[model samples]
Target: MLRAATREAVALTGHLLRYPSGIQPEQITDPGAAPPPATEGEGTGAPPVLLLHGFSDNRSTFVALRRSLLDNGWPHVHCVNHSLLTWDVHEAAELLGEHVDRVRRTTGHDRVDLVGHSLGGLIGRCFVQRLGGDAFVRTLVTLGTPHAGTYAAAALPPHPLARQMVPGSDLLGELAGPTGGGCATRFVNIWSEHDLFVLPAHHARLEHPDLAVTNVRVRGVGHLMLPVDATIAAWIRDELGAQPTLFGAAAERAGERAGPGRPDAAGAA
Candidate 1:
């Protein structure tokens, strides 16, 4: 127990030091700032990616993972800096809708992908499932998000959003309704076994029967480290680049079939 606590503490400290204000302009690539020229073999023509940080965190929270995506061929990566003072997840989701629209308009892409961490993930789901954002989103990837709400939040102050995150909260109950049905957007839920904030860890999984969901279990990483972990970043990059599959088993098969040095019968001339 002490070791796990020590690890989480170190990871949290690193996260705070890396993005004290949650908005580090130098580390992230802003699509609005001078758009990068599309390069062959790069993320050209791919869907634009919009990153959302966890609660009380800034766009800087995605610094490491964004760098990894860019380094791996993802060209258009953008981050949204939501205010910590915001009290409601629905309001945050509304702001996310605006940002998604802006990204689509500026990039000239019909759709974009969303990658959210922790509280940001919940906000993203609210946008996609509740705010009609599924129309504009191709994929929704979340890391350490509590889709089912978390008991751990019960210990926090009863802030509006905080209250919404506690297990059995009204917000979660409403969100758990018949949403995500017939939505075109795909969902990828990733969580760490050692995540301290997402009590029971399984709360991170999205269990909607109609929504196409992929639950990824990651071990040996803490909740705070999900965005910074190199392995998780690589997995996310690959997932973004590849076509979406039905579930984890199909995704694995798809990966094997598309592995390097393999001939593509579908693309053969």
Candidate 2:
């Protein structure tokens, strides 16, 4: 376990060093170099997917996964860069709301699917749960997020957002209230068994009574690699492609009984 953690840490460091600022400005603005748009006959019923990176990370972190989705017939995939230094998760969620609205307006799609990593997952959930984002989000997929907060966060330097991520924080309390109730969006929480940053990795799972939630267990990947992991990317792509339906209260109960680390019956692409 120690060796695996060390190896993952080194790889994650390399990923961060390679794309320090996340997505490059040129990649966003280069019209001629953009990923191919969906053809008229393809992706006719699928909603556009919006990718959100973890705290202190940029849109570039999703480059590989985004490319994989596009190649597999996902019509539109967009990434957002949030303020790296923002200290409030709610504030970030508000910003994300604006971005979601813009994507809906620009694409003429009534709803979009969200894929958020780490802190980005919390931000997206805040929008869906508190900022009226459920109306516009068909599905919410989170990777390596501290849904229940984590002790690991307590070790970080004091910051409002970091404080909020500590177990039993007020912000987490508010966000945890009856999530998924009366919301039309489906929630998929994906976490890695080997994620060190999330402390007890199961803290990343969502257990809400009123929401349709699926807790997906992934092995081998670490916190930073969740977004880049090929198996995870394929699972997310499949989830996004499926039609959105409320999982209902009973189904959620059944899932809980099944416990965690259940193999992804959907398999990989």
Candidate 3:
């Protein structure tokens, strides 16, 4: 009973999945002789944005955003691989930190923006909070992130790693607890009212006053529809393209020194 459009879309997705669609290292670098740094503190500035995909998904999830950012002149888009089928939130955080450092070093920028989906958002938060990532990230945007637990976890197998995402589980609670470190980063959480994986839409919204969390309402979008829709991309671009509305006296002064409205001023670290 599949519609012609649906069948065509499925075939196109299959082709994209099978294609080597990632942006490689050489592709990110150049031959002007002033190569991007290999570590933090080694460049003019770090890449402007970083994209992290959700669980069971690959770097291709952010393909559209990557193209958009590049076309918008915000290059240095890197999508992370979460060691899928063997997920580890903590390790994923560490890996994310390393990638952030790499971007900082290579691009010579001190801070970068982050866009994450689902579990990738949790992992990004961990990086900002516990993995010394606050110094390198400016803005954090999450799409369909389960700030609480997802009801769909109930149907998942009782595997050790899978338990991390189980609804009402201790792991999810720990992630939600106050870590007391990455308090300065601005955050935006996007969610869909019709997400089948996460019941109680609020489960996807973070309730932190210090965090600039925006609970976006995308209509009729599913849990696994990160790249299947256009609204989320527009939301992310809008959030990242704006300046933070709140910053204390100390941070505000430092931000002013960096130049207001510029990407560097928005740098959280």
Q: Mind giving the per-residue lDDT tens digits that candidate 2 earns over 1-269? A: 56446657876886767686565532232232323333222355467788988766788788888898888876668888776567799998998887777666655667888999988899998999988899989899998999999899888877787888888998889887875459888898887777899978888888777778888666666787778766677667767877332334565465532212334333311
Q: Report the backbone clash tally of model 2.
A: 1
Off by over 4 Å in 2: 2-7, 21-45, 179-181, 243-253, 256-269
User: Which structure is stronger by TM-score: 2 or 3?
Assistant: 2
Report the lDDT tens digits of candidate 1 across residue range 1-118: 4544676788788877877656643233226643443322236667778898877678877889888888776767888877767989999999888877776656666778899999
Clashing residue pairs found in predicted model 1: 22-58
In order, candidate lDDTs are 0.75, 0.75, 0.63
Candidate 3's error at 269, in angstroms? 39
lDDT of 1 at 214: 70
